[model samples]
Structures are given as structure tokens and as C-alpha cells.
Target chain A: MKKYLMKGNEAIAEAAIQAGCRFYFGYPITPSTEIIEYMARKMQQVGGTFLQAESEIAAIYMVFGASGSGKRVMTASSSTGISLKQEGLSFLAANELPAVIVNIMRTGPGLGGLGATQADYFQATKGGGHGDYRLIVLAPNSVQEMTDLIMDGFDLADIYRNPVMILADGILGQMMEPVIFKEPEKIEIDKSWATTGANGRKRNIITSYNLHNEAGEEKALYLEQKYKGIKEQEQRWEEYHMEDAEYVFVAYGTSARIVKGAVDQLRKEGNKVGLIRPITLWPFPEKAFIPLLNRIKGYMVVEMSAGQMVEDVKLNVNGAAPVAFYSRQGGITPQPEEIIEKFNNSYHKGGEQ
Target chain B: MGETIFSKTKGLTNTPFHYCPGCTHGIIHRILAEVLEELAILQDTIGVAPVGCAGFIEKYINVDFQGGAHGRAPAVATGIKRALPDKVVFTYQGDGDMASIGTAEAIHAAARGEKFTTIFVNNGIYGMTGGQMAPTSLIGQKTSTSPYGRDSSQSGYPLDFPLLISQIPGAAYVASVSVDTPQNVIKAKKAIKKAFEIQMKGIGFTMVSVLSTCPTNWGMSPIQSIKWLQENMKNYYKLGELKTPEMLNQ
Candidate 1:
């Protein structure tokens, strides 16, 4: 396998092409602008379409149009730009259209500065749009995972007939690393429900609107069942140093890397600390926590936001294990020493609580 | 079987339209359906349906349709056209949908010269939502929201949307027509057919703005509304083929 040194954003673009995504609709925005720029130059060569929409709002609607046409489509944006896409995202999910969306993190809540921040954890996992829906969120910490997860993201989108999101921060987006491009696996799914010209058949109409209230409620129940199946089947995570560990740090994305560094240092002091890093942030690694809930003394969630993922941690833990949270807000990324110091203070060093 | 000289277009579905008694949306829908049948493009066509009264157009058209958000049909049509260049695509949008809420999507799609057609039904007031003021509502026109007659200072003047669309360099063909009289209906059909034909040629963006009436929303009887539109709407909106590819090149 040839190794290509590339940034996470570039890897996402190339990986999507390899995954057979022929349509990309996006607007230029920070931390992920390279994804669209790369597509603009490379798409026509691959026999695909690339359009820089007038606004993020237009780009996502463009995603709606292409996806409805039975093609694999994608769009990428950062914090606020993703916010502009929420309305279209709701329409896509309600209509059950398959598309991939990537949100590279930036400090936000009205033009927060350009350093990396995991502040959008709640917005990404929870439906940011005005509907009861969930985006299949994939969090990639490194450039290689960015390539792997984006390829898998498109597959998951088609398999489930819903939008899948690649959720990462600026640290992973811009940072370069050597990545091996595996031969792309072709996953074929049925697209008979798609709105392609309805040529020799009954006209297919794609809409999220249900005229009657009962029909809307019935559709909501159907979606709930699909989500239940996803939760049962798609919980993914990485367990590090689980054997004989007394305490664990629960984290993901950039925060997970910082927690790992803290875990390695704390183990040297015989602290018996481990890490549970979630790869899918929505159908969160609840299975990883359930088996250890009775045995582990406490779980501390480290995030770059002010306690967003910690809510999920507490919900999953459900009082079996004491859950604590430490975070840095507004683009401040904490170092491993900070996590270690906070852990020692929170658990009193020996899981005695 | 007796020989038939006239028949309904196969381009329309069996589903009956639910438009109000005096609404001109049915006329526009009929002419649009006729254009598709005449061009032999019904089987290879896709439509983007706008919100408001026309939002339900997906049910009535025989071709495939995608329903857009409040005013995003043009953006949606751009996506469909770009993805399937061999297929003919168009958007049927209302005044409130295309002009008031979806102004950016319309202007930019035309500016980019996206290869598609737009049938903008300019009904002056918000029809589906029960008579609210629209960007196309004329000065001193009374609606439920603008009960005191649309004040120019408060509501701004009526927007001549076709004039704006025709000015865009990417727009290959643009026309503003009325459906009041029988002769004018014939002329409107010609413009509608020409707009779709331009799309088949893979020319730039094309649009035909049809001045429509809403009797229920205008608080008039069906006959009174037709007379009111002829006297009032025709006076304000210029009716003709405003721009053509020929004009653009010259």
C-alpha cells in the first residue's frame, strides 16, 4: 500500500471520491474549505459534479436535490455553516434521503475564533434541526481515521437511508499524517425509492411533509424503530487498558487523544487509569460502559466543550458509576497534565470515593 | 371511436388540483403540462415544487417531483439539473415563495446560468396562507395583512421579478406574461414552451413569470377577479418576452 501524507480535510475529499460519491455541494468555510477546493479541481476529472453554492443554506439544499436523484452526495462545513444546514438536514432525514455531511470544529456561538473547539458535540449528536431525528455522527481523531470513517460514512448513509456526519475538530482537519489508502470496498444498496425521472414507472415523489397528522405520527414511530435498530447494531468504541483498571476517562475526537496521553502517564504512577474512546458519538458506546458500570469506581469525561458529552456519559452511566466532567470552552484545548491533575483531585488518586 | 381533435395532456396525473375556485394556478399547471407533452419530454422530466399553493404540484404532475422548503426550489432544481444533465428539470414557484423568501436562490441560480427552467406564478398576494401581503403585491393593494392597502413606505413597491431575472447575464430567456384573456393565455403558452425549449438546447437559465390571480385571497368573485386583474395587474406588470438568447447575443 502506498502511504500518502495528507491533512484530514484532504483525506476526506479523496476518500469520498473513492467511495463513489459523484456529487459534492458546499460553500467555502474555514477548517474544511480544502474539502470543497479539492473537489472543485478533482470532481470533473472523476466524472462527477462539484458546485460552490452561494451560501451554506444553498449547499445543503443542493445536497437535498442531488441525493433525491439517487446519487451519493456530500457537503462539508464548519460550526456556523453547519447551523445554516440544519433546516435542510431535517428535510433530508424526514424524507429519508442518504447524504454525507462533515463538520470540522471551530469555536462558535456567533463567530468564535478559529482555534479548535469540540463545542458542537451536543449539536451534532442531538438533532440540531427542527425535528426528532439523529445524524449518525463519526468522530475521527487522526488523518487515517478521517479517511476510514468518511468512506464508511457514505456506506452507512446508503445502508440506513439517512444522513451520516463526519464530526472532527480543526486539530485533525489541518494536521498532516501518513495514511494508507485501502482498496475501496463497494457496498451496493437499493435506490428504487429515489426520485430519478420516474421513467417507465409510477412517478416517485420525495417529500418530508405529511398532510395528515396521523400519517406524520405513524412515520415518526417508524423512524423511532429504525433508530432503535441502529442503537442495537452500531455502537462502536475503542477500549484501552481495561483489564484491572479501577477508573476510566471517557472521551472522543481530539479530547480522546488528550485523555489517552493522560492515561499513559497516570499508568506509570500505578494509578490503574484507562480510556474509553467512542468512534460513533450518537449510538454512543453505551455497551462499553454497561459491562464495567458495577466494577469501575468512576468515569471522567474530558471534552473541549463545557460539559456536552458528559451529559451523554451521565445518561448512559445512569448512577451505576460516578460520572464527572472536565472541559475547556471557546477554543481552549487542555493538555494531558491538566487531565491528570483534575483526575487526581476528582477521584482522590485511588478511586476511594 | 370518433376522431378526437382535443384531449387532456398525458403529462398530467389523474390527481385533481385542490386550488381555490378562481385561482389561476390550474391554468398555469395546464399550460405547463401541455408544454411538456408538446415537447415530448414528460417521461424524461423532473420538477421542483415550491411551498405555498403550488407546493402540492408534485401530486398533479406526471413527472417525478421533489418538494422544496419555503423558497428553495431554484437551488433544488440546480441540483437535479447538474446531476442529470440529460434530463429536463424545472421549478414551479409562487410569488411569496420565489420573490419574498427565496430571492437569493432564484437570483443566484439564474446568475450561474444553471440549465433549467422556472415557471414563476406571480399571484401578488400570499394565497395559501389566506391573503397576506407579498413582495409582488402592488401599491395600495389590500390583503388580510395589509388591510389598510399596501403602503409603499411600509411594504416597499411591487417587485418586477422578471425584470430582475432578465437582467442576469446567465439567464438565456426571460418573459413576463398574463393569463387574463383567451389571446393572452395563448401567448402565455407560447412563452412557456419557449422557456422549456431553451432548456432542451442547454442554453442558460430560463424563466416565464405568469401573472396570476387569487379570487378568495383578493376577496372578489371569480368573474370580478378576472376583470380586476386585467385592469390592475396588466397596468403594473409589463407583458411580453422581455429577454431572449437572441437579445443576449446582440
Candidate 2:
């Protein structure tokens, strides 16, 4: 393993290259453009292709084409840019194409701001675009996790033939941290499903259009089963100081980082506060909170959005304990001290059940 | 038994085309299939099919195909060709799909000089969507959308895509041909073959814009559609090569 102090976006790009990703298609968007820039500088040297597409719409389709051809491919965009990619993302999901998409999320409903935000939790976890589809969403709190999750993201994408999203935010994307990259794993994937020229086999066609009712139903059922399998097998999370805690904080990505700080400070003050950070935002790791529901008095959901993920936490808790939410929206992030205050107020007042 | 004089190209599948009667997309598909067969690259070619009537080309073509969203085939072809440079990559796009919603993708692909072939079918109307007015629809032409005829004051003039593509510095070959006649069909095949050959040579972006008849959309008989294309489209989209590698060398 080699250790280097790298920016979060740069580390993700390098990890993708190390993971055998050979094609990158992107259009410049703030907070995530560094990943594209890094790929442009390094992909060519590694005998890969990095293309700056005309638009985010075009970039994602390029990824669709490359991934359909059995090459590991990726793309990066910020909030509005990612929103622009939803159409192609839907197509990618329907085609069952494996691709890595990094959304270094910024605040948005529409061109909101360039600062960090977790507003896209709903968009990422739920189907962002048209149709009944889901992306395997991975949230990384640190630059190191950014590298690790991206490598895992590609593996999981290929294994399930689904799009995997590394859902970070501007903070994690811009922050510099020491990252250790292990030797690239050599992966041999079966090309039988790929559309890489017919040569000695039946012609391979990749498309999302299912005109017949029965065919569409079968496809949807197959995808539903696959998603269920993923939920059963791949839900990931990290528990910090949760063994004997009364109040637990649920967060992911940059909010998790800040929540950890708050938890540490509250523990030093003799408060029984802990954190449950979700790594896989899609499968949600609800099981992590299920067993702890009886032990914990309440769950404090901290986010960079308007309490989007709190709903999920509430569902997981399921009346076993109250779930309270505190959020800072439009690119403003709450500090550790602010979170502590919010927790104290909520914990003392009894969270909403 | 006597030797057969003619047979279908092996590059095409047994699946019958879904194109409407009198539509020219089948002719264009046949020409492309013949070219791929003649070059013996059917086993190594990957085609990008655009959304529209020709979106189902993958079903009829024997080579591997990636279906692209409406107007995004050029970008899709760029990705495929860039990822697998050893494979022959091409895109089959309609005029509405290419010149209208996909204008930026087409222009940028040509400007980047991505090594691929594009077979652009300009039928002057949207065939699959019930004869909507296309970006290539002629002035004063009437369609489902332009019920009172295409007024230049409202929708503007038709787009000359080959002329636009040829102007890009990255494009190595650009041609405008038609399938309106047997001789023109031969010339169109030659142009398609040249575009594929240039892609094989890695000579940068190449495109062949074939002026085709949309009898169903144009509200004309199959014979009248051909004659109308011969007279009207010929006046706007001039036939023959617009740019070639030799021109770039000069």
C-alpha cells in the first residue's frame, strides 16, 4: 500500500483508475470537476480514455455506452449536473449496465450553491429519475473512505450489473486527507453480457426498452429480486461508541464527520452520545439501528438538508424510540458545538415520537 | 444448381425491419449492412442506434448494437469507440434525432474528431412520432406539428447538417448523399463505405448524411416522396463529398 495526502476527489479518481476503470466521461461542475481534471491528466497515461462531454446529459450516456461495451467507466457531477444525468442514469439502470457515478453534492433545488449539502439523500436513495429503479448509493465520510468506497463501488456495480453512486459532498470532495491505496486488484469479468462486437457469438444488444407487457413485468420483477438480494447481503454501516449510549446520532458523508466530533465532545462531558454512520445509503443498514432501538433512548438525525434522511431513521426505529432531526440547509453546515446544543435541547425535551 | 446472382448480406439478421412501407430507413440499413459485409468487419463492428423509427435497427443488424437516447448516439459512439478503439464504431441517427435535440452532441463529437462513423438519415420529418416537423423539414412544408406549413418566421430554416459538420476542424470526411435512385443508392453506399474505412484507419470523425424520403410523414406516395426528395432536398442539401482527408492535407 502507498500512502499519500490527496484531495477527496483526486483520491476517488485514482482509486477508480487502480480499480481498472478505463473510460471517464464528464462535464465540468463545481466541487466535482477536480475528479474529471485528475482523470484527464492520468487516464491517458494509464492508456485509458477521458472525455470532456458537451453536457452532463451527454456525459452520462457516454458512460452508458462504455459500460455497455464491458469497460469499467465513471462520471462525476455536482447537484444540478447530477440532476441533468437522471435521464441517462434511468437508462443505465434499465439496461443493467455497471458504472460508477460520483455526485460530489452541493446544495440544490436549482443551482443553489457550491458548498456542501446532503439534500440529495432522497434523490440518491430513491429513484432519482423516471421509472422504478435504484442506484447502489455509498456515502463516504472521509477522503480515505472516498478512495475505499469508490473501489468497492465498482466491484459491487459489476457484481449486480447496477449503477453505483459514491454520494459525497463538497466538504469531503474538497478536504485533503491521507489515503492509502493498496495494489490494484486484478479482476476478470465475464464479457458474455457485453456488447463488444459479435465475433464468434450472437449479436449483443443493450437497451432499456421493453415494449411487451410480460417482458417489462419480468424485467421489473428480476430487478426487484436483485435489489432485495443486495439489501440482504450488502448493507454496510459504522458504529462509534454505541455499546452503552442513550442518544445516538444518525448521519452520513460530511454530516457523519461533524456528528462524530459532536459525539466525542458529548462523551467527554459524560453524556451517553454515540453515532451510527451509514456507509451504504441505499440498502440503508437499517439492521444496525434495529438492534439498538431498545438500548437507545432516542435518535438524533443530523444532516445538511431539510430533514430528508430523518424519515428513514424514523422508519427504522419504528416507534421503539423517538427520532429528532436537526439540519442546516442551502449549503450552510452546522458546527459540532451547534449540534451539541441541538442534541441537548432535543434529548432533554424528549424527541418527537 | 446454378450459382445465385444475389443474396442478402450476412451482416443483417433474419429479423424483418419495422420501418413503415415506403420509408427509406430500410434502404440505408441495407447499404450499411452491405458495406460492413464487404469490409468483413461485421464481427468487429459496434453500432449505436438512435431513438426514432430506426431505434430498432439493433434487432435487424447482426453486429453488436448499443441503443442511445434520442440525439445522444454520437456521444454514445464516442464512448464506445474511445473505450474499444480496435472495434469499428458507428452511429445511425435520424435528422430529427441528430440535428434537433442532439445538435450539440453531433457538433462536439465532430469537433473532438472522435474516431467513428455516423450515418445520418435526413428524412425531413419525424417518422416514428407521427410525422412531426423536423429540424430538417423544408420551409413551407406541412406536418402534424406545423399544420399551417413551416413558416420561416416561426420555426426558422432547415438545418444543413453535413455542411455544419464539414466545417468542424476535427472531421476528416463528411458527405451528403441520397437513396432516391439506384445510381444515388450506389453513391450513398460508396460514401458509407468510405466513412467506415476512415474509421478503420483511425482518421478522425467521419459522417455520411443521406437525404431520405419519409413518405408516411411527408404525406406523399412512395414514388412522390422520392421525386419530392430529388427536387426539394437536392436543392438544399447538395450531394457529394463536403470534406475529405485530402482536403485536410491541402
Candidate 3:
């Protein structure tokens, strides 16, 4: 492994190139522009394509075209740009094309701010686009994880014939950390379904339109079963100091990094606290909490949003342990002290029976 | 036994068209299929169909086809062509899909000189959506949306996309032809063939705007629609090669 100090956005670009991604289309937006700029400088050197599209809408559709041609393709954008891509994302899902999208999320219901926020948690996990579909969502906490998760994202997309999203916040996009660049791993992929000019086979048709009722229903059933398989096979999470913990902090992405610090400080103060960091946001590792539900008295979900991932935590807890939320909105992250203060006030004050 | 003079082109599938009786989409599809067959690149060609009456072209054209969102065919074609430069790539779009909602995409695709062929079909109104006034609808034309006969004071005049695209230096081949008569149909086929040939040579963007008719949308018979198109569309849109690489050389 070759180690280097790299920013999160640059690490992601390098990882994508190592993962065999050769086509990149994007529009420039703050906190996420570094990835595109890096691709612009490096893609041509690697014999790949990097296009600054007219808009986010065109960029995503361009990805759709490139992915249909059976190439490893990717695109990156920020919150408002991601919203513009919802239509193209829906088309990619409906056509069952494999691609990767990265969202370096900013604070927003609209264009809220350029700072970091996890407000897109609900949007990422709950299928931001129209239609009954799900993108395999991966949340990365550090620069290294950002690199590793992108490599994993491409594989998962091809394995399931679905789109995968790497959901990171502005903080992760801007932060720098030491990372070890792994050599490109050799992976075998079947291109039997791709539209490579038919090549003496039946002509390939990549379309989302199912005019008849039966055909549309069948596509829906196939996608539902695929989601179920993903849920069963791909739930990933990390546990810290969980053995004798009475209170657990449930968080993901940058919030999980903050929660780790809070858990360590609370443990030094003789509080039985631990952290549950979810790496895959869509799968929502419910089984991790199932066995420890009785021993854990309460779970606190720390997020940069008002309260989004808390819903998933509550759904997973299901009354086995009370779930509370501590959050800061509009790009303001909750400090470790703020999380600890909220936890002590809530759990020790008879907040959870 | 007599020699068979006419037959269905091998480039087309066995699927019958679902277009209206007087609509010219079927004619356009047949000519495009014949061109691909004549070029002997049907097996190595990928076509993009846009969101309009021609959206179901994949069913008729026997080649790899990708369905594009409304007004995004140029972007999609750019992707496919850029990814597989060795293969022939093209997009078939209607006026509303290209000239109206997708104006920016088409222009920028030309500006980038994306090496692909675009077969732009221009009728007066939006046929698939029940004959709404399109961006290319004539000044006095009346449709469902323009019941008062398209007033230039409110709705803008028709947009001549071929003329607009001809101005771009990146555009290698640009032509506007009609399908109203046998002579004009021959001219349309010639232009379509030239556009594909330019793409085969890896030249810059090429486009051919084919003037067609929609009898159902115009509330006229098939014969009436042809005559109406020739008389009105010809006056506004000049039928000839608007630009070519040869012009650039001279």
C-alpha cells in the first residue's frame, strides 16, 4: 500500500480510477468541485473521459448513456445538484443500469449553505428519486473510508444491477487525512447484459418504459426482490465499547466520528456508553442492536440534521430501548460536549424507562 | 418468377408500428432503417430514441437502442458515442424534444463537436401529447394549446434549429429536408446518409432536420397534411444543406 496525505475529494477520485472507472461527467459545485477538477486533470491521462456537462441534468443522463455502453462510469455533485439528478437517477433505476453517484452534501431543503450537514440522510436512505426503488447508500466517516467505500460502491452496483450512492457531507469533502492507496484489485464482471452494439446477439434495448400493466408489475417485483437480497447480504456497522454499555450512540458519517469522541469521554467519566457506527445507511444494521437490546438502556442518535436517522434507529430499537435524538442544523455539527450533556440530561433524568 | 423489387429492410424488426395512419414517423423510421442497412453497420450501431412519438423507435429499428428522457437525447448520445467511438451512434428526436425543452443540450452537444448523428424530425405541433403548440409551430398555426392561432405577441415565432445549428463551428454537417414528395424524400434520405457518413469518419456533430406532417394533429386527411406541410413549412425552412465541412474548407 502506498500511503499519502490526501483530501477527501482527491482520495475519492483516485479510488475511482483504481476501481476501473473511466468515464466521469459532472458539473462544478462547491465542496464537491475538487473531485471533478481532479478527474478533469487525471481522466485524460488515464485514457478516460471527463466532461463538464451543461447542467446536473445533462451530466446524469450522460452517465446513463455511458453506463449503458458497459463502461465503469461515475458523477459527483452537491445537494442542490443531486436534486437536479433525481429524474436521471429514476431513469437509471428503472432501466436497471449500474452506475455510481457521489453526493458531498451541504445544508439544504433548498440551497441552504456550503457547509457540512447530514440533512440529506433521509433523502439518501429513502430513495430521493421517484418510483419504488433504492440505491445502495454508503456513508463514509473519514478520508480513507471515503476511498474504500467508493471502490466497494462500484462492485455493489454491478453485482445487483442497481445504482449506488456514496453519501458524504461537506466536512468530509474538505477534510484531509492520511490514506493508504491500495493497488487496483482484479474483478471479473459479466457484460452479457450491456448494450455493446448487440455483437451478433439479440439487439439490446435499455428502456424504462413498460407500457403494459403486467410488464411494469414484473419489473417492480424483480426490483423488490433485489432490495431484499441486498438487505440480507450487505448490512455493515462498527461497534466500540459495547460489551457493558448501558447507553449507545447511534450515528453515521461525520456524526459518527463526533460520537466516537463523546463515547470515549463518557466512558472515562464512568458512564457505560458506547458507539454504533453504520457504514451502510440503507441496510441500517438492525441485527447489531437486536442482541444487545436488553442490556442497553437507551440509544441516542446524533445527527447534523434536525432528526432524520433517529427514525431509523427507533424503528430498529422498536421499544426494546428508548431512542432519543441530539442534533444541530444548518451545517453546525454537534460538539462532543454537547452530545455528552444531552445524553446525561436525557438518560439520567429518567428520560428512558 | 418475377424479381422482388421492394421488401422490408433487414434493419427493421417484425414489430408493426403503432403510429397514427397519416403520421410520417413510420416513413422516417423506414428511411433510417434503410440507411443503416445500406451502410452495413446495423450490427455496430447504437440509436437513442427520445420522449415523443418516435420514443418507441427501439421496437422498429433492429439495433441497440437506449430510451432517453424528454429533451436529453443529445446528452445521452454524447455519452454513448464518447464511450464507444468505434461504433456508429445516432439520436432520433422530435421538435418538442429537441428544439424546445432540449435546446441547450442540442446546442452544447454541437458546440462540443460530439461525434454523433442526430435525425431531428420537425412537425408543427406536439403530436404525442395531443397536439400542443410546439416551439416549431408556425406563426398562424392553431392547435389544442393555441386555439386562437399562435399569436406571435404571446407565443414566439417558429425556431429554425438547422439554421441555428449551422452557425456553430463545431457542426460538421447540417441539412434541412422535407418528406412531402418523392423528390424531397430522396433529398431527405441523401442528407440522412451524409450525416451518418460524417459520424463514421469521426467528424464533428451532424444533424438533419426532416420536415414531416401530422394529419391527426392538424385535423386534416393524409393527402391534405402533405400538401399543407409542403406549402407552409417550405416557405419558412429552406430545404438544402445549411452547412458542411466542405463549406469550412472553402
In model 1, the runs with Cα more than 4 Å from the true position are A349-353
Which lDDT tens digits does candidate 1 get at residues A1-353?
A: 99999988999999999989999999999988899999998999999999999999899999999998889999999999999999998988988889999999889899887788999988889999998998899998899999999888998999999899999999899999999877777777998877777778888899776579999899999999999898999989998888888998999999999888999999998899889999999888889988888799888999998789889888888998788778887888989998888898889855422
**Per-residue lDDT of model 3, residues B1-250, tens digit only:** 9999999999899999999998888888889899999999899999999998988999999999998699999999989988998999999999999999999899999999999999999997899999999999999899999999999999989999999998998899999998888887788899999999998988799999999999999999999999999789889987799999897676
Candidate rank order under DockQ: 3, 2, 1
DockQ of each: 0.79, 0.79, 0.83
Clashes of 2: 0
lDDT of 1 by residue, B1-250 (tens): 9999998998888898999998899999999999999999888999999999988898887899898699999988888888889999999999999998999999999999999999999989998889999999999999988999999989889999999999999999999998988898899999999999999999899999999999998989988999999899889988798899998888
Question: Pick by DockQ: which candidate is best?
Answer: 3
RMSD, each candidate, Å? 1.4, 1.6, 1.3
- How far residue B79's Cα lies from its native spot in candidate 1, in Å, is 0.9
lDDT of 3 at A48: 96
lDDT of 2 at A188: 66
Steric overlap count per candidate:
0, 0, 0
- Model 3: CAPRI class: high
User: Which parts of model 3 have CA positions greater than 4 angstroms off?
Assistant: A351-353
lDDT (Cα, tens digit) per residue for candidate 2, span A1-353: 66899999999999999898989999998989899999999998998988889999999999998998888999999989999999999999999999999999988888888988999999999989999999999999999988888899998999899999999999999989999997655666676888888889888989876569999899999999999999999999999998888989999988888899999999999999889999999999988987886688888899999888899998899998778788888889889998988888887766432
Return the DockQ of model 2.
Answer: 0.79
What is residue B138's positional error in candidate 3, in angstroms? 1.4
Candidate 3 second chain TM: 0.98
